[model samples]
Target: MTNPTANDKWFQDRAVEQIHMDQLKRVELFNGRAAMLGIVIGILTEAITGSGIAHQIGLGALVDGYAACRTQFLPFCF
Candidate 1:
């Protein structure tokens, strides 16, 4: 006969692995969404700020900041 305790342990391990996989999927989805939103916001900001050398510089900075924040803080939010 199979040991009930060993069977339960096996099932529990599989469940934990599944949960980790789901969390990873959610994180990837969130990252993609945040990246797209950042691009849109950067373009809009540049447009509203007006065309000039300053606008390009500002847009680059904004996009870089957004990427940094998304990488550093988004995991905690998720």
Candidate 2:
């Protein structure tokens, strides 16, 4: 007495899949944005802390300067 073929579930399945895919894309976008923000914050933090420490050590005084350059610059650059 019922027409099962008229109630095809394919459309429902497709709708669900599309929703999931959209959510995945949004998550990926958020992750990319968060990574970019993290990199900026990290660089700013390093710039502030590194320069402050280097200044205290005497930036151009050969002995301490070269040592600081080697110890600090190397780690930060890498």
Candidate 3:
């Protein structure tokens, strides 16, 4: 017969793993949202500024900034 204590430990481990996976999924979701928002904001800024160069630079910078924030402030976020 399987030991109840071992079975409980297995379930506990699985729960921990599932929690980690959920957190990761949330992080990915937030990151995607941040990137999309950055893109929209960047496009609007470029349109207002009337500069194609600004559009490219702004988009890249905003996306990278969001990614950096996600990595550095993930704990605070979720």
Candidate 4:
């Protein structure tokens, strides 16, 4: 079926049935999805270069400027 109507039983069973209606479950689902997206992006960027994505993009200089503003510094160097 190319396009299933809302009234169709298959659509209800296949699509709507899979969704989490509860607020907490929906938040957990979204969090999981976001984590998966981050993991994929991290791995892809890492595969392109041997270094972590932040270092590959030269983010240390940006952090160095902000380090003194905070007692706890960003761990770019260490």
Candidate 5:
């Protein structure tokens, strides 16, 4: 027969583990969002900086910026 205290401790440990897992998931989600935001911000910064006065303002700047940001950001993923 399992001791009552042992069963309670097991349940408590499981609960704590679940909570930690949930917190980790939240952190992952937050990090993903932050990374996405960083990419977007980087792109916008590049585009704003690149928009020449003569041209009709194009998407090329944004794309280039995204590429640059990706290269810079990928290393952090590891």
Candidate 6:
């Protein structure tokens, strides 16, 4: 598979510019990276507890109650 290569000079120039001229692109990039980190943390928590991310925090009871209420046809779950 042949992939097109980026212009080295342009890439270098953009990298240098970003160092001082932080733009929306930088914010978006950081947001995406933070989201990835959150997902990894969630996955690690699940692996350690063998439970969903919700239970990893403190919503396990609320979620379980809601689920039970829904299954048993109760009026209130929360």
Q: Score every model by TM-score.
A: 0.56, 0.55, 0.64, 0.41, 0.61, 0.50
Worst 10 residues of 4 by lDDT: 68-77
lDDT of 5 by residue, 1-78 (tens): 889999999999999999999999999999999999977776776688765322234444334556546666334332
Candidate 1 has an lDDT of 0.74
Superposed Cα deviation of residue 18, candidate 1 (Å): 0.9
Sort by lDDT, best first: 6, 3, 1, 5, 2, 4
lDDT of 6 by residue, 1-78 (tens): 533355767788889988756777788899999999999999998998799888888666556866657676456655
Q: How big is the positional error of residue 24 in model 4, measured in Å on the Cα after superposition?
A: 0.8
Name model 2 segments beyond 4 Å from true: 1-7, 51-78
Query: lDDT of all the models against the reference?
Result: 0.74, 0.69, 0.75, 0.67, 0.71, 0.78
lDDT of 2 by residue, 1-78 (tens): 756665557677888999999999999999999999977776776587774433444653333546656677444433
- Residue-wise C-alpha lDDT for candidate 3, range 1-78, written one tens digit per residue: 999999999999999999999999999999999999998887887788766544367544334547646666344443
Each model's RMSD to truth, in Å? 11.9, 9.0, 12.8, 11.2, 10.4, 11.0
Candidate 3, residue 40: how far the Cα is off, in Å: 0.4
Q: What's the lDDT for residue 17 in model 5?
A: 100
Give per-residue CA lDDT, model 4, range 1-78, as digits (tens).
455564587867766656645666889899999999988888898898766756656764444555534534544443
In model 1, the worst 10-residue window by lDDT is: 53-62
The residue-level lDDT of candidate 1 at 46 comes to 64
Candidate 5, TM-score vs. the true structure?
Answer: 0.61
The window of 10 residues in a row where model 3 has the poorest summed lDDT is 54-63
Which stretch of 10 consecutive residues in model 2 shows the poorest summed lDDT?
53-62
**Candidate 1 to truth, TM:** 0.56
